[model samples]
Target: MGTKKYRRDTLIEAGLLFSLFYLPGYLFLAGIPDPRSFNSLLYNLQIWILLVPQIFMVIYLMHRDDLLDFQSFGLVRPGAKDIPFILLAAAGTAAVVMAVQVTIMLVAGEVLPEEPLWKLTKYSMIAPVFISSLLTGYSEELFFRSYLYTRLEVLDTEKWSRLIFVNILFAAGHLYEGVPGGFNAFILGCYFSFLFTRKKNIHIPAILHGLYNFSALLLTLFL
Candidate 1:
């Protein structure tokens, strides 16, 4: 009976965490008139800014439950050894994203639309883009990769099942950017999951995720 109650509590906590992290995205999707425009970028930044308090609350709850530690979440101070893994994770993300696009093109004969997925209408938007990338890198990884994955492990979920389950939601969360964006996000989500699992370091994956976003924004700016 105690075991049953514990499992129920775990499930409840995980669900609450998930909703807390993602509910705003769903609620605010309707507000962006053009997803590629400068205004859209600012809107995303605002969402992250507003989420600061909620993020702190979520962290506090996770700590209170003793669900994670500094090492578990890769919150420790880094050394030079960590740099290579960070770069590799970022490169792996790019490779996976490209591979997915190529596979879709070859199999379905339809090109995934890129314009709607990333664009910046003005040069002045660069600073906000960087800020958005930084926030996205750490925040999303905290929720999607570290917290959700840890909870699933506690639930005794199968490894592959956990990967697929988390990435599906990760992808779904990006559906506001359109189907292509969601598809890319799904693939990259899988890559980042693998990185975190192998390295036992969320910080590396977070930095990699940030680099990828920053690169995408730069590509839109120059190319």
Candidate 2:
């Protein structure tokens, strides 16, 4: 039946999205260098190369599943009012996350690492982080929350189930950051998911994501 077929297709698409995002982190954990390392240049380049092909593959898969809508993937233009708020929220969220990170390090008596904090100060590093953040945040949101959540919504699924599923996958994708980072990412994913569900706009969440990364970049520089 068409109903059963639709359900099957939805499951497959969700699975693919989850795997595309998380598998790289798993590989990285198997032994990727810290982004602050001298060899981080080579490490980041390899990850970017791997990411591009997966991106195209996800796009194709989403298109095939009929979930590739403009708004869902953030292709829709943002309004002027949306821009300012998004930027402000992004900045605030980034600041808060950095504060928390610092507090944690202070409490643990772990002195901040001396290496260059941002990979973007160098040309080779800039390309990967910028492209990776934009693409990964935009595309992943489209696949996980926008496309997948929309389908789940139509299916009359429970709200909590939707939130948990999407958040878990989102967190799982950051597992390469280690257990602490993974836990933090998972918690943040839940917060962002709530924001998305309430606002029904990807700009807010995307800006928040960018802000978080930008904050981390600054912390590396000044901490």
Candidate 3:
């Protein structure tokens, strides 16, 4: 038999996780007009810094309690057979997201905000955008998909409820983006979550997330 679940503490742990790490980080960066501000960068680096330890904590807690293993959490080391599938998942998901984003753009005919995101023009931002996208993609996916999904598993939430609620929370956490960003995040969360549930691999979702982010960065040229 497996270790007993911590069913009662599910919501408590979720609240604590958000309040302790994400909430403070969001508040710290709230007033910054530009995402590249000293404050914003600090917020970015700080959250990821906190996230590393938190990742370890979640892994340790789950493993110690026998609730998770490398395989269950999709932390398995990719062997020879997994690489191509992973690459295909990432590339295919990126293509789909690009098409969706472009459709949204066309439907709304919205003007791209001046100084959106990194404040670097398309030609000048290759390296910075790549770095930012990778970091955000990896960190967010690890937290939301890998860790939070596990947390939800111990709750009373049903399968569909778990899926919808998790995606909703993911969108809510993207509050920095205001309305449009929240919408985009919700859609991306659903897409990535679908992939995660299907593949049972965090790496798949993370790779796709990163690729999508990088492609979105490239899209800045036209926006």
- The whole-model lDDT of each prediction reads 0.74, 0.62, 0.66
lDDT of 3 by residue, 1-223 (tens): 2324455455566678767757775667644356443224444465457556766765565565445566776666656786888777767676666765676588666634455663434465566556666666766787788777766765545777877887787887666766666677887898888888787778778767777777765665555
> Per-residue CA lDDT of candidate 2, range 156-196, in tens?
68999988877786777665555556656766777677667
**Predicted structure with the largest lDDT when compared to the true one:** 1
Error of 2 at 152 (Å): 2.8
Q: Which of candidates 1 and 2 is the stronger one according to lDDT?
A: 1
In angstroms, how far off is 60's CA in candidate 2?
4.3
Candidate 3's TM-score reads 0.76
- Model 3 root-mean-square deviation: 3.9
Ten-residue stretch with the least lDDT total in model 2: 111-120
> How many pairs of residues collide in each model?
0, 0, 0
Instruction: Write down the worst ten-residue block by lDDT for model 3.
Output: 35-44
lDDT of 3: 0.66
